[model samples]
Target: MPVWQTIYSELSQYNFSVFSIMEDKNIEDARPWIEKSGAKFPCTIDTNHIISDLYNMFNVPTVVWIDENGKIVRPNDVVVMNEGGAKLVKVDPETYIEKIRRWVINNDPPMNSNDDFIKYKQQREHTDNEQVARAEFLIGQWLYNNGELELATQHFETATELSPADVMIQRGTMSMRGMDPMKDYGPIAGNIIKKGLRLYRPIRD
Candidate 1:
């Protein structure tokens, strides 16, 4: 999302922020990107997955639109800032800035027509079930790091049910695919952790 900021929020001159949702799960994995982006914007941690659960977040990159009344005037696919109140079009950076100024001066909401609203709504995917799966997956990651393979397997497998295509969840599921953990971890703990890691594919892999 940040990569497209030049043409999106930055060009349009709107404040942007990120919320990394987890169930009190640690996400040191994102440290490098956070530092490098030099975004300066505060990134929030949603330990309870409260916002994700309520907003039907299934994917990592999802957007939500909230109105001034704190109501979701437009729920999903809130990225269509090219829409000038009703009509959507490709605008130059100058045009985008002008529209933003008009909106601010007019005290008007970013507008979308009924048709545009329908299209946006159709794009919103996922629900609370998927959010729970995310939380469980994070818990499994914690367990795996702490040498609690058996407990981690339980949560990881459950996460696959909610989002079968999710790579991290799939890796955890395949990690124990053919191995007998009790035998492996008991006799060769070091080999088990390493060899078990080999079973689960990384995103980089």
Candidate 2:
């Protein structure tokens, strides 16, 4: 959030817009955090996980950069802009900010030609299992909202098993029980760190 706050403050002179989507198990649960951040940009709560399904989001703090032409300049990636947010991931936040500034000045920058951007889009192409998992995850969200804990748990579990690579479903399940998914879910955290996967798969120049 500090990262986002920084971008919102520092980049106001540009014509770009900055907003956020809180993709948690419940909006009420996420509201306090959003309020505490003192975010100036628009923020919306995603209850149905529809954005997650559309973008193939598997983690928190992912950003998608769209240009003035309404085309995706960059796919979903981490947009950390401070040392604190970069501590756990060991990424350089200033590097990302510089990229954003460059994009604002030059809409069709050479960074967009990078292979990682292509890979980011390619990664979102779901397989058969992932598609099934997404359905189960959505069903789980509906069930959980309707006060069916046991049935909801079953569906969420099925979704997790089917799409083991998707962290969002696993985190959603944990959040429903008021648990810290990143700290508590051993397998998910291990996979993220061990595989050199992007904690937030942002494009790098």
Candidate 3:
């Protein structure tokens, strides 16, 4: 978050602004981190995971490049901006930042607008079950907001089962269900790995 603040400080001159979103059910869960970051950029909490649903994003730290015209030039790309984050995600942040710099300062596109990039974005489109899972997740959120905890939990679990790879639905709802995301995510992550599923798939240029 601090690194992103620095990036925004550097790139805002080029009319580049960072809009950070936390896909947490509770604002309190994301508040302390937001306060700690002291970020000058616009930061918002998405209790319903609306951004994820809109962009077909599955994980945290996803970066989407939007142009001045409000068009998404880059979609759902995993970008870690710090060394620790890079190591954890097994991605090189420097290269990604270089792309961002070129795009922002030089007005160069992030990657070659080729068949591969087109295919990558196409692959990111949500599957039918995943779309159903999103519906279920939203229903869960509605139920939760309406004070139907048990029904909400059931819907959340159903959503997770329908789209286990979607951390937005799985880990994002944990806190609302009285589960520790850090502690509970380990087992779910382990299962995902055992099944040869990737929690974070970095699409490189």
Lowest lDDT sum, 10 consecutive residues, model 3, at 109-118
TM-score of each: 0.48, 0.85, 0.92
Each model's lDDT: 0.48, 0.75, 0.85
Q: Runs in model 1 with CA error above 4 Å?
A: 1-25, 46-50, 78-111, 114-146, 162-205
Off by over 4 Å in 3: none
lDDT assessment of candidate 3 = 0.85
Cα miss at 190, model 1 (Å)?
Answer: 33
Extract clashing residue pairs from model 1.
none
Using lDDT as the measure, the top candidate is 3
Clashing pairs in 2: 77-201, 77-202, 78-200
lDDT of candidate 1 vs native? 0.48
lDDT of 2: 0.75
lDDT of 1 by residue, 51-100 (tens): 64566543333344454466664453222233451142232435434544
Clashes of each: 0, 3, 0
